[model samples]
Target: MSTDLPTRRAPNWLGAASAGLAVAAIVGEGFAIGIASDGGWGQATVLAWLVIVLTAAAFFGGLVATVVGLGRGAGMAAMVLGLVGNPLVLIWLLGALGTS
Candidate 1:
């Protein structure tokens, strides 16, 4: 008889890729795409860009942690933090733009 041992989480390279793609999307959508549009952009748009940048950074950091053999939970935590930060950034951007 044979039994399988429990496996650790997959390398989760996707998490890193996810982070990179997210960054590209943000830059493409908010800065490049918006600026290239007919109407000019605003402070809110800039703020949205910032959020995406931060999220990208967090995802990279999480990837590093995972590569260093840190627990998957910690890596996931960092990703979650970025996810939480995203909406708040949008809200702040909206309020700031409105007041300006």
Candidate 2:
């Protein structure tokens, strides 16, 4: 038998994409809050919904990346951000709408 070595490639971009999406989601939520505070409930509602959807997508995408042996650090960061950010934004949105 010949002595040989297999080469390993760098991880794919899913983890980075997940991280980017999570950061975007957080910014979107902040924008939604600002809009709501400015008496723009309609716009805020739409933005909040969009943020929620993006957060979910990022969370799942990160999980998939991690399982696929990609950038687990970035993926985990995205997942944690989604887990913490989504609910807080949702609650704030709900409270704002309820009081309006």
Which one is best on lDDT? Answer: 2
Q: Listing every candidate in turn, what is its Cα RMSD in Å to the true structure after a full C-alpha superposition?
A: 8.7, 4.8
Relative to the true structure, candidate 2 reaches a TM of 0.80
Write down the lDDT of every candidate, Cα atoms only.
Answer: 0.60, 0.86
Predicted structure 1: lDDT: 0.60
Per-candidate TM-score against the hidden true structure: 0.38, 0.80
Model 1, span 1-100: residue lDDT tens: 6698888765655455555544554554466445547555675567567667777676667666656745455666666656645645657878988994
Off by over 4 Å in 2: 1-6, 88-100
Which runs in model 1 stand beyond 4 Å of their true positions? 1-41, 70-72, 83-100
| Steric overlap count per candidate | 0, 0
Candidate 2, pairs of clashing residues:
none
Error of 2 at 61 (Å): 0.4
What is the number of residue pairs that collide in model 2?
0
Tens digits of per-residue lDDT, candidate 2, 6-51, equal 8788676998899899999999999998999999999999998898
